[model samples]
Target: MRSLRRTASTLALLGLLAIAGCGSGSGSDASTAAGGAEGVPAVLNFSAPLVGGGEFSGAAMAGRPVAFWFWAPT
Candidate 1:
């Protein structure tokens, strides 16, 4: 009876350790999805004609902060 109790306790400990390991893997996956490994911004896609015109002239605000006002064509 005592040996059976000891075996049950050992199995319970092993099961807890396995659960902890699985939980840690999920946390790491969440961290990776939350913006790569860290210190990196997620890439975003933007459609264009980009708040300006078709001309690639030097008159465009390339390196400057520009406010974009979008309107639905409907």
Candidate 2:
């Protein structure tokens, strides 16, 4: 009976997660203000200071593909 209860609870949790995952797919006001979903920019132009020193420019790699990897010790 205890195992049956646990299985039922697990199934219930999975169903809840599945329902939550299916979002309304509607853009918020802030997203629309920032050029909406369809208005994605072709070129990313921004710069940020590196941790070790030096600035990274997104504009420099405008025509090329770029990939980023973020890691946290904790």
Candidate 3:
């Protein structure tokens, strides 16, 4: 009974340590960037010239949700 108890305690301790290690950052640039604060907003701005010899400026889709789709020429 004592041996079983000791084994259970050891297993619990190992599980906690494993969880802590998994939660720690992986010490990589990509990992650091991925750990940013939740619900934070990111903004990207750009201006491109139109094919009809005009400039398109301003937020193309401000205050709106946008989805992008890509098509292949296959």
Candidate 4:
């Protein structure tokens, strides 16, 4: 009886570990960026040519959530 209980407990633990291991890693990697764990860079400065006829500055977008997108052809 004791052996059965121990085996059941071990199986439950292994099951939990397996599920955890398969969980999403994106959240962790996103937070730990090049700047630091918070992933935000201080005094961030970026300028890019606008499609119409202007430039964009990262400083102007400070304090707002920003996302960068890229496309690559295979």
lDDT of 3 by residue, 1-74 (tens): 99999999999999997997787664322221134333222331434566567866424544455643433346
RMSD of 3: 16.7
Which sequence of candidate numbers ranks them by TM-score, best first?
4, 2, 1, 3
The global Cα lDDT (0 to 1) of model 1 is 0.48
Q: What are the runs in model 3 whose C-alpha is more than 4 Å off?
A: 24-74
Residues 34-54 of candidate 1: C-alpha lDDT, one tens digit per residue: 633342222211334534566
Question: Which wins on TM-score, candidate 1 or candidate 2?
Answer: 2
Local distance difference test, each candidate: 0.48, 0.60, 0.53, 0.61
Model 2 pairs in collision: none
Q: Which number leads on TM-score? A: 4
Best by lDDT: 4
The TM-score of candidate 1 is 0.32
TM-scores, one per candidate: 0.32, 0.35, 0.32, 0.36
Residue 59 displacement in candidate 2 (angstroms): 0.3
Relative to the true structure, candidate 3 reaches a TM of 0.32
Which pairs clash (backbone N, Cα, C closer than 3 Å) in model 3? none
- Candidate 4 per-residue lDDT over residues 1-74, each given as its tens digit: 99999999999999998997797764333222254324344434556776676987655655565666533448
Q: Give lDDT: candidate 2, residue 52.
A: 86
Prediction 2 global C-alpha lDDT: 0.60
**TM-score (C-alpha, index-matched) for candidate 4:** 0.36
